[model samples]
Target: MVPRRILLETGLECFRESLNDLHAPATCATHLIGCVTTIFNFPPSTPRSNAEMDVMVKAVEKHYEFLNLAVSFVAVPRTSRQLLKLTTDLAKCDCPMSHPGSTQLHDLGQHWVNDMACKDVTTLLYFLLFVPSAILKGVNKTRVAKGSNKHWPRSISDIVPFGFDALVEALSQWTVVLANPIPLLFLGDALHVCGRPLFTAVTTSPTFMDRLISLLRITCANMRRPQKSEQLPVSYFYIIAVFLFHVMAQRTSQNSIMIWVRGRELELYPILSEAVTITKDPKLWPRTVQRDATGIAMIVNIFHAFAFHFSKDVPRPPGLHPELAPARESPEIEPVIRLYDLLSTRRDECYAPGCMRSLQEVGHAFQKCGACRKVTYCSKACQGADWKNTEYPHKLICRQLQSFIAASGSATGHPKDNFFEDFDQAEAEAVTAPLLAWVKARDAQKELQDLEKSMRGLAKTEKDEGAVEMIPDLRSNS
Candidate 1:
């Protein structure tokens, strides 16, 4: 009945006041939710002017501000007991009221959490930083209490009705929002903050682990360039590799990894192979060749360990049947192999323009570019001439070239037939050879140490047979 613009302005003002106070009343929370719902439910069929859209965006921003404040409130408790009490109170306050098209306060809270996670970078960071610890500590307390006769007055379920579902939804939303490189950079501290709890939760929950693997595949596939000049940053690729390493390291159950590998092999293998090719190409990632190389090595080592340690669990090698050719053949791997072979065969070609001389053929000493060290020349004269040339001036665009190289390192053309044949052998020797050897040595040493410890324990038991017989059972009955 009232003018929509006037109603929106009033709601915004009330929401602003509530946000300004640390201890806002429950009514204020309810009022703010009402305001957000009103704006969202406004007629979609009616077209709006540019100015109206601007106002709508501002309203959405305000809604996020209110949601962020709610997370802060939830994070106020330091200990499990305090968190339990706060959660119980929140659950009570959040119960729905009888009204048309109205959501409960708790439902609103959950919606806000999910919405903030997808839309606001700052809110997402806060959610990652505070929510996981709160949930983990609360769950840990419940676990401890269950072992004793004494019980906690309240459980974590009292606070989070659906348990870790909210957290899972938040993570899923992150995958959707992180489809672009620019937003991936905004993830700044969230990755660091969420790492431990994320590792803990994924290892403990099969559903969480499944969601994380799905997220990884989506992120890797989306990392491709939509345009020639619009490639993702090298750091983004490195971050994905680091996350995969952490997940792999924390896995205690082999079944989960096996399931993931089998189900996701079609999607995951190519991305990984592509990652290896791009990182190894000096011309593609000029300045970051060493760092990218190291990252790729670590990732490959992790995969190698997975394959070596759990060979029985891993799926059978692809490309065994012609009828199933596409399923086994990877588009991402062949281009890399071809590119590597091409570069290896032409190892001595001068990179300088119009110079066809090869260091190997001419027996000339080659000089490397000091800045990128990616390209070589037959002589210093060619290098100087290339740098000074106006048509292809190397100095002006050296840094950009390095960035481009890093961005597109893994972007080879479509997959080739029979690409999977001898793929693992070539990849292991090229990318992960050194690191895999080191990992094997370390694992062997650990096994030897464990054997010695067991031997000593057996010796001690034999020497103290009488004493061991005298010792009473200390195991608890309850």
Candidate 2:
């Protein structure tokens, strides 16, 4: 026996290094397998408590996050498949070579991530910036190529066990992030960067969302039982709810909206509400809301549903759902600017005479302009005035802005004047109202086009006196 303690330490060290420098794939694999085997079969000879195990695992996870970051910036070998296989094999390996938990490594990675919900908007913001940038590409590539329904971790049976309610709660936390404007914007941009065509497979696929929802609900309902060995039950209901809202809010796949909600609610609500209402009359309902594997699974599924949209082969609703169609919210907002607009703006900015010399941009020196005290400027004069006539509107706005602002807390107008007090309360209306806005914008564009066409016809008819007008100019003004 190679001293179980020594083997565990060596394996853990290698696993850490592999995740830290993901480029060293072979080394990572060897270390990961070796460490897991030692832990499972031999158990640390000196013995270790659950807390110590958690510390070690957390250290490894931090390295994993770093690896994900590095991999996002640089290209790597076809490690997705290799990693999947290694993890799968490790899951099945006999004592001293696999993770000790009932759920396999695959299940742990697949589901446990959201077990401890995001603590606050800041963490959610970090998730927005880091997660999509890191995982979208890899997820899309693997999903598109394999057309596998396998989610993150490929198999939840390989890691820590979770239940559905836990899953739903975990996912709900992520939903709260998406509902935040700043994080939502970046995540949406990342989704766009990952592109739509690739996502068709996931959104459109039959049973992907449905199956995931079912799995999460079943898992979450059974979280408290120790007898339920194997699958970590974490209900994915909340995540599913959040996902359905996001996809439907964006008007992506109308097909799955009702099905996902109905199915998940049927499976999850009874259990989740129990967890949610546990605080009601604590004398009567004593169980705290701490969730098990099933609950966590549900949560992961919810986020996974929308996140699946980033992968290829997720189907879209070919046409809007009948109930969702006609006079409802609009689809997602258009790109912030058009290509023509960007080109024109860039050209004008570069060529304009008397343009501000102190505009802050990448590669420019970072400094605060004295006059505005809000906007960044390389020089004092540029910050002092926007124009001689209009006054410094930007400065005034910036002066009133607070540095430590939550996405929801930054309110505009007087409390009495502004109807909406907080972003969270306002999101439902703000997001849904865009549909009406889209319709108005669309109708306006059509009117303009029709007017232009009529004008062109009038011009042509005038040039050719021999021609007779078959149709009258039907401009609204006319």
Candidate 3:
């Protein structure tokens, strides 16, 4: 048997060779992934010194650069438009068993189609999961203090050359891939790995925010449609709800809530309601429900709070159904309500100690600090005065304040584990009762309208038949 040192050396050399080969990118990627996986899962029997382990870790660090190169070689488009086109192509090519002609297709051909459609996305998912672990493997724990920013695990984007725009574009591409449930599970894992940064980037972009919200709305809307409901992946919808929940929690502005609500509280409510329904469905994944419970609750409660907050300024949508309003608020939603109240109240207070300018007094005209966004000033002069002040200068503690707000939003005193330990099925149903009732009432209303229209059409037809019969009699008399 070859010596262990030689084996590791040989593996390292092979990995290096693969990275240098530009022509055979797929081959290189496959080889590099194999080598990196082996290094990460290095066997105990293979004796190695600490120095040797460090060497192996350093070797694996190159994997990120190689991954970006491999992706580039695959010709994955960089621009949003091109990525969208790619997404469309993949979605169209994904053949479900229910699709006509899918059954008759040869197994090999079907497999080829599946691979072609899923290749890039699967590669991306693997990169997201593996690269972070690889980078951390080489990190010196002794040098990094516990609870320090350095000790906190970094995202794949933090290590790689991939920009925020590229990450968002990749996420957009996966939004289309979600049409197929099988690939969507993988996409969810990828999202979990990169979700924090992606959420931050998405919150900053109005266009991306709109696209994501539209995707959620369309997906949930499809779930409500009888013809399309079976084809719809309810699990994917749950994943999206979780994603949206994260986005909503981190959003720096209340306007984000309004933008998402978009006068469609009637439509948005059921989606949250159904998410709660799916969470309790024994046949589905319960962990998804647990993971998403806070977000779902937060959004539903935020909707309620915003409705009350903007009741006067934002005119109620025309023909707003009474059933859409909650019959009664649940105590469980109080935390979210309190959070919103706190946010709204805090925005009115000037960050500067001496200045007294309120958001209520001036409205959205108040200027928020560009960096942390935790502070607002009524004018540039107030902002300048606050920044230059010797006592509690805004510049000194802006990042700390921003961090505090971020932490509060994410934590929210919600227990991550055993989320439903004390909460029973009966209680779950009780909390969701209003939303479920609204959905039922809306659906019933639709069915009633459809029935009435059908009846009206039938009566018109009968009248036309009688008129036709009279026409012949009139002709005979004439």
Candidate 4:
């Protein structure tokens, strides 16, 4: 048998050669990236080492093949675009059941799509969203502060802006989910990071949310009643749960859901309630994430929180069970909306009262408010009107956004786990409750005021001056 060192050297050489193949470098690189990800599943306690760090750095620290590591695929612009191109190309495939590897390829596409969706967002926010990045960014920031300015933190976008922009441009040109859901699986993971712009893209796409929700509904249905031919790929469950947060973010999305729920085109509350049962039973998912208690809770709570949050705005049909609304207030409901409210608008649409035009309809980006830097409008006039509107005015929320950076303790050298997974959501909602209650009450009061004014208009006032003449009417009555 070959020695272990020899085996390592041979594999490394082959990996290097495959990446440079002129015929199909992108395909070769994609497979390599995909397999390592699929094969090496491990829990948090699994041991790891820094040998997997930068190859060049490791080589410098010891004797090794530096040349093989020199031409990183991501460093070259052509290769970067090729990486994304691979996803688009693979999306065209139908993923026949004959080859189970096709499913693995589809899973790898999810990771690629997540990266593509997130690259355009602000790096600071992106770092906080992911679990690992939170730790890394904090350490990196402290180190940077201790060092000189030149040693400051940097991201791929900072060093390779063109490469990054090319990836985003490629993404825009290709409409995902029309052909396959694989590449777009975890795309919504970045929604909270990219915020309003990403939210607008999801809602306006027309087919994206429809297809996602349909798949989700089908997945849940299949889960409820098992059948051979009706079975769907298991990835749909996780992807749908993560991606559907877009529907929970804003009023427009909730309005669309209202239509769906009303027509019985789609329903989520029942499925979410079933999520606990579906995720808990090992016979259901076996050794996957769903089998774990934490995973079960996370999946179920995510659905419940989102559904509960938008419960009032998006109504359920009469006699729908669970009421879809768990409580009058939830940590996930109003505060989450308010904290992320800066990005809660449909960014491509006009924010003014009378005109809710879209960039797609108008074929251009709209003007934005300079003060809060939070909203956009069709024109200066619309912006002015929105700012001056008496009820739910943009002016009120603009400065609040300025004060609301990340969360209460995110940038204050404290961890951001609380803002996301770790925070005690039930307890904290109380603090934001009074403010939230006032906002809702004020909205209801405005609605009530409008109703009263309209009803009063039905009756003539003392100022009614129309005299004309019932004389003609009197003759008719006689």
> What's the CA error at residue 235 for candidate 1, in Å?
2.3
Q: Choose the strongest candidate by lDDT.
A: 3
- Structure candidate 3, residue pairs in collision: none
Encode model 4's per-residue lDDT on 108-139: one tens digit a residue. 53454353332211111111122221122222
lDDT of 4 at 343: 41
* Predicted candidate 1 versus true structure: per-residue lDDT over 205-256, tens digit per residue: 5454355455555544443434322223444455555444434433334454
> 92-170 in candidate 2: lDDT tens per residue?
3232334333224323222222332322222223332333233332233223223332443222211111322222222
Q: CA lDDT of each candidate?
A: 0.40, 0.33, 0.43, 0.41
Model 1: lowest-lDDT 10 consecutive positions? 144-153
Cα deviation at 460, candidate 4, in Å, is 10
Give the candidate number with the greatest TM-score: 4
Model 2 segments beyond 4 Å from truth? 1-193, 200-235, 241-439, 451-478
Candidate 3 to truth, TM: 0.40
Could you estimate the TM-score for every candidate? Answer: 0.33, 0.31, 0.40, 0.44
Residue-by-residue lDDT tens digits, candidate 3, 1-478: 4444544454444444543543332222223433434434433222236555555455555454444443332223345565454434433333333322222222323333233333433433343343343344334322221222242232343322355455455556545544332322322333333333444555455455445545656555555454532322444554454344334443445565565445555554554455445434444543232344644444344444444432323544443323224333434443343232223323444556576544433434466789866477878888888987754466655654455444443343324232222222223333344324433443454465566566667667888788322212221332
Q: Is candidate 1 or candidate 4 better by lDDT?
A: 4
How many Å off is the CA of 467 in candidate 1? 30
Backbone clash tally (model 4):
0
Candidate 1 lands at a TM-score of 0.33
